[model samples]
Target: MSLSPFRSALAASTLLAGFCAAPAFAQHERMSVIANGEKVGFVDVARTGNHVAVQYDVKNNGRGPTMVEAIELGADGLPVSWTLDGKATFGGDVHERFLRTATKAEWSDSMGARTATVRGTGLYIGQAASPWALGLYARALLKAPASTLTALPGGQVHLDKLGPATIGNVSYQAYAISGIDLSPDLILLDDKNALFAVLDTGGAVVREGHDADVPALADLATKLTAKRYAALQKRFAHTVDAPVRIRNVRVFDPVSGKRGEPVSVVFANGRISGIQPLDAVASPSEALIDGQGGTLMAGLHDMHAHISLESAILYIAAGVTEVRDMGNDNAFLPDLMRRIASGEVAGPRIMPDGFLEGRSPYSARLGIVADSEAKALEAVRWYAARGYWQIKIYNSMNPAWVPAIAKEAHALGLTVTGHIPAFTNADAMIGAGYDEVTHINQLMLGWVLDPKEDTRTPLRLTAMKRTATLDLASPRVQATIDRMVAGGIAHDPTAVTLELLMLSRNGVASPSVAEYIDHLPIGLQRRRRQAIAPIASSADAAGYDGAMAKVKQTLKLLHDRGIRLLPGTDDQTGLSVHRELEIYAEAGIPIPDVLRMATLGPEQYMGRDQELGSIARGKIADFILLPGDPTKDLSELHRISMVVKDGTIYFPSEIYPAFGVKPFVAAPKMTLPAPTPKLAGSGPAHDAMDEFVY
Candidate 1:
């Protein structure tokens, strides 16, 4: 929603109360206006020279409050200003929805720019400043828009006008329909209300009835809306949190920093109220299950996940309780959120972001296709309504747009984080308004290094040399870090992402690259995995080692400052996270702390310590039983005996990531006979080809 109102008619007086930006002395007064045999509303004016302000309001003569969604006006009649935003709801009427402008009305003039939250209800018709004024309210209204076009009786493109009508107290108009997707789709119309773009969606149908806005056209609107709010209804049902109890388990609590202990855990009414010794179990009415002496720990969180049924199911199966979805199609988000929360589907809790792009080649591929500052602001609002938790400003956004979008996101209670291109670095974004800077490279690029460039990079030989050592002790680097600390900026140090970025070894993805390819969806496993396959023909092992040096320096700097490091792996499958822990050790995080980084560090960042992030009395039952303590043989984590997420159990180690219809349980892992012969480490064994690190 932009700061301006839908029309010049409403802008004068709205938002004037105590607004520092509003002009002074713009107060309401008595005024008269007559039309259609009744008085509606009029503007009260005050002016000093060229600047003037007006105050006004519309009074409903009808039983309900007259609702208005838009008021467009501007010089040359181009609707230079509009405040059409946010959907409208009147009391108990559920089907009513509203749209003020074709898109969120982003405001600008020869002057400058500002953002708005389009806030409205009911059917709204006509062009900007149409001279047609009406109040809307409703009793019985639409049920759902017709969303499935395939099942409809018949349709040769139909053109019908819907309203100047009312059902209780709302209005709407419908016209020119062709190619309504089987799933409910959105059709972008120009001011003439003629279709400009038809967008496919898994949307709920619009509820409708015959009335004035366009009686003959009412049925057409109904036909246009079809799909079952299947996605939404499914999501809404799953949000229920059932009571769970886990008894007799050794717990590893992150906050308490405790491990290797047995405890009885109880969860009821969605909160962990107690944790006692395994022998001290108390009776409670909830879903109680015995942990059977297995180790219990905090729920694992994946920093990045793309929403898909298979992926979501796998997240829960893998013991990941929550995930942060970096970016996805904005239009699909609202219903997606509803479905996830309703528990209509089984998946980890998700946090989504709306795409924010600049004038880059990748713009339209995501929802970021924007050109100007105003366009960028509208993109933010467009996603804001759909439930994106943050503004994921992408790699190609203009440096200037970063500050503007960040400010708007803050104002809207949204955080800004993501990759900014070479044009804008982390320091400037943080100084401007970035709340969190993502990826270790961005963090490093700000103070540590110029970064290892690719074939397209234009670099100076001297700068390349500086990329080796991050002068953490340097005053300049410390100063920037100090500000980041003072500002409470969270660093999602995905060390694995950096490993991939740095490991262009002969262009093979990495030594571990081919391993993850099997975990991908069969239909897409090859196509998608091929793009990132090992960097064969790429640079050699030396480049990887150089990158590791900065990564190590980054670790020391973050450790010294006591900065908050979110253990996130851009690695989708949670297994990659363990690999990340190993890499964390390589980058120099002591193994114990690195383990904590995965188990507890994330919970504290989530601010849900009371309910999650460890194995202890009264904690949610989440933890994995490893073949051995990860503190000793860090690789033991790979040999998980059992994994419990929210108390549901799964065992995947025996499966060994083989791409199968299902992970097989051929037999539980068994202890092998005593080791046989040993070989000298001074000589190359298994794959001498893999010993490039030396």
Candidate 2:
């Protein structure tokens, strides 16, 4: 469910918001947009007097934004007038404009138009600006008092100097610009304060001819980000060395589909030691957590995810203790997993799935890109040897190579899953030994599309419109269902993702995210309200509405047919996992079953049920404390009070504020053991005292 297309557009809109960085004296400049060490696009800027024009394009994995920006800079180095016209990543039209006059400031974007009286020098951040805008922001902030400025529309921007670094005998000053989103943008500027590069772990937009510096800059970005997360981990992750006792909580047993009577769950050394009676005697040495009659359930699992350092903490905050990474940067994921395991960072338990794609101009740059049959089989072995739970075949994979690849993966005891390759259907892949299909659209497209229709592009998404008129009871649809049922194949619907793509409208919050939208950051709030799919007319909008209805119907049909449903949000945020389960319940699946799919079902699917998934003596200590029972109302998941992953406790109330989210609930009362006092005869009183820290 990565929805890389829409995410790329959002990333381009936000990540490159300040990319316009040419000096007024400069005539022209060019830069390369590098993603995962590969050049994906470029930003070209031409200046004539006070007016500048920017042409920005990024093409990766068959989708990206192409933006044209025109700007008029004021004497203060902020834009007085700016216009952006472009095609968004998923081919949606983008027309954003901002103008500031002597009396007022006005702007219009996907979020609609607004005006405000002129107060001071405010910089307008475009929803679809080029990479040059970041440079524009950096340069202006450098001259402002304390390197801070009032940003237009809302919010403030603050810049911090990150000192200087020398790469290849060239020195550049690095600075982090914050107050824009959940994370800061780390950019390097030349001696003149001109934008040198915008760095991120995923990619970098480097000044032209400085591509060689991308790798180093990206590594630096990762280290800087990791340092911030590490500080948060130290601040939040509470590791009680002694046994922890959570009292007055009812345990939701997935097997029985009901909550037991209030009891005290005790755990130590990252394993549940006992489930005791509520009236059991208390141990003075144990840490006490008062659940206050809340429900204690096994930590939820997001069956589909692409984990990042930021999303890792979000997952914990949302009660997702485990995540199945659908695909990710091969070089980055292993280290991230290691850090999570060693308590160096905060994140969910990651079950890695190796990504395999065929070499092409549109290939995803995350994992292995095989250009031949041998390379494909080699990828299967590479994943097997490295302990990946499965191999995910992507859009560009050759259908002809799947059989051999699946065979190799099966022989190595790894499950086969992924998008239905371009020019092929789900039925063909299932016949070729696919244990599961990645997305619901990937599965349904086989029934609605012709064999020659290519799904390697955004067609896989836009073509879902055809399903609006598709008959569920048709023989063609049944045949695919029959195969899936007979083979016990699973489906990762990522239903929330479809809701985002098909049902989102400009300036209106999508139904799936409406419940929690107001609690998010302004940037994310705006992103969620805008449309990802292009809807030019009422008819087009109706088609998408009907398509979403059909998608739900298809989900109901699949679940009714006894097909395995793996709840996943191909989205990065932990909040989307809650929405994913809600969609399942909304589609008529029982709430208890949806909860099971999110918790125990995934553990069972991955053959780790014996050690994980539910509350029991000797099982791993991974569960969340909620104020209400999710088995009755799935939305209760949003009210998670505390999450314990492998015995380390985290309070959602404490984690949300770091990302600008309003806490859903206050943390439960936690009481640690009293510190021991030193005796008069003890040598060195400080060394003899017991200090308890969270």
Candidate 3:
């Protein structure tokens, strides 16, 4: 999924760290935040006598955090007291405080309060820290023995010195800090160890007057990230040369909603060649995989995803072999797809949806942004020429232009799907030729909101409270459902995203992530336990709860009325897709049907079921090996032992650790064919089989 406007703002906050200094008087510095080549925000820092004060404000696409921070540094250059007060990415109140003493430390933020006894020293990773905090952590780690320090709460922080880099006439040293997040945060420092710039693939926060180098810095960041993932691909991706035989496995047939008898599935050249009886003999030259009586089913599909280098591998690890990229950076996505196709990266097969947003203050910076009706049509043609599967209209789009845009897209044989633009309703979009609606809130908000209430802001989320009291049986609600059914409009509810927003609470894991939150990295674990939607009172909390129930109720209502429901999670982690399936089943859809929606349903919807989706003769081999039948229990989807996509086999256990995730299950035995003997004249046997053993 694309970064929520809120998260985009939050990530922007971490793009720059302050320069370390102990001025006798006072010093000041300023930095600019650039995202996708656009100046979106700024960071200002004032330091006086070991005390630092910062004001960070960012406005990109009309929404960003405006934070004020105060910090007192100890003699060791670590934060002794820090206070942050501001509005979060979605306008949620942010009041975080952290204090460290020689004996102990205490802090309280949105995730609630905690205290830890200090031994010698521990770095407190602030939940809502400003960019300056990065410098604080970096300076402390550089001074520490081995350039490593224990982080409060949990985990450790390690720093590695990357090679030097130069921007313009100035030379700088680069460093990478790991363990604080899934991907290492890369920063540049001058000879004095003063932070100069913080680089990110999406953007960069560079020292003032150096903004011209943002693109170069971002390119460096992307190359660094690509290099890391490339290494991982080399280490984890296993390519099979000979025909592969997966023996002793029962296949779950989504078409019949039943498990077939144990069979030996054979595939060659990335296509399933046969489904033989368990007693069938295998060729000695074939690679043999003992399934150990597991259930093999079609690999799951995440219908809504925004592919990133990190999420790409995570998707494969979670048994998601196919993903429909709802939206993405126009240039970056195709290159990523190319890498995955060339085996330079490990990722799912991508079906990209061209993202089209109207030019507005709140417009998201992805895909194509059009300012006029002519530009909108041009964007449609652009996507058509590029062969986008569909055109996804975003919140800032003009409702008046959707009809023409949709018409143009239809003429070019591209389907239209997306958020209900501000001031417009789902009914209007469907009439305008939207084949599908993107989010549950986008569809339901039209019923609960005034025409003047803009959905381009967080109101699209907080307004869900109004849905708690909405009558599903009312005429207006039924009319929209009827319109959807009549128009064959599909819904990509992304219910898990809404659940994460509305139902989340401080110190409480949202039900959507409760099952596997513990398996996530420490940073993500903390985030999952925090609230995204600001709850002001008991009434507000209850309203959100009731709203979630109504969301499920509305889903069931749509299902009953025969409106096709597409299972999707606007979440990148492949785990959320499984939760999305659970939510669908909980919404009264049958377990078997939910599995179908995740497997064959999306493939059929995308018109690729002929060569993909299920495990059958002549079809591409994209399936997962699991310990239990997902048709009976959707939760079993998480326990994937093996995933085979286009004949490339991946054992989750072998890769999960690379991301700091504990293995869910051990990989079953896979015996490879013996390498061929080389002739005396030949230097050596050079077949791919001689490269490695699985």
Candidate 1 vs candidate 2, lDDT winner: 2
Clashing pairs in model 3, backbone N/Cα/C closer than 3 A: 1-306
User: Cα deviation of 35 in candidate 1 (Å)?
Assistant: 51
Predicted structure with the largest lDDT when compared to the true one: 2
> Each model's C-alpha lDDT?
0.45, 0.84, 0.82
Q: Which stretches of candidate 3 lie over 4 Å from their true place?
A: 4-26, 680-694
Per-residue lDDT of 407-443 in model 2, one digit per residue for the tens? 9999999989999999999999999989999889999
Question: Global lDDT for candidate 1?
Answer: 0.45
What's the CA RMSD for each of the models?
Answer: 22.1, 2.9, 3.1
Candidate 1 deviation (Cα RMSD): 22.1
Backbone clash count for every predicted candidate, in the order shown = 73, 10, 1
Candidate 2 stretches greater than 4 Å from native: 1-25, 144-147, 677-694
Residue 292 in model 2: shift from native, Å?
A: 1.1
Q: Write the per-residue lDDT of candidate 1 for residues 1-694, one digit (tens) a residue.
A: 0001111122111110000111122222223322112233333333443322333333311111123333333221222233322211111111112222433333321112333333221122211111122110010011113411111111211122333323234443433222211111222222333222221221111211211222222223233322223332232221113454456666664544456666766655444557766677454323444555555566567765544433454455455667777665454444455654654554566767676766543232344557888999998887787667778766557777778888888888788877644554577878778877777666666554443332111111112224465556788777768878989887776776555444423213353334444443232222222112122233423444565677767776786687777666665445556666677676666776776777677667666666666654556655665434566555555455555555444445322232122332221232212222248865444421111000
Q: What TM-score against the true fold does each predicted structure earn?
A: 0.54, 0.95, 0.94
Deviation in Å, model 3, residue 348 alpha carbon: 1.0
Q: In candidate 1, how many Å is residue 656 off?
A: 8.7
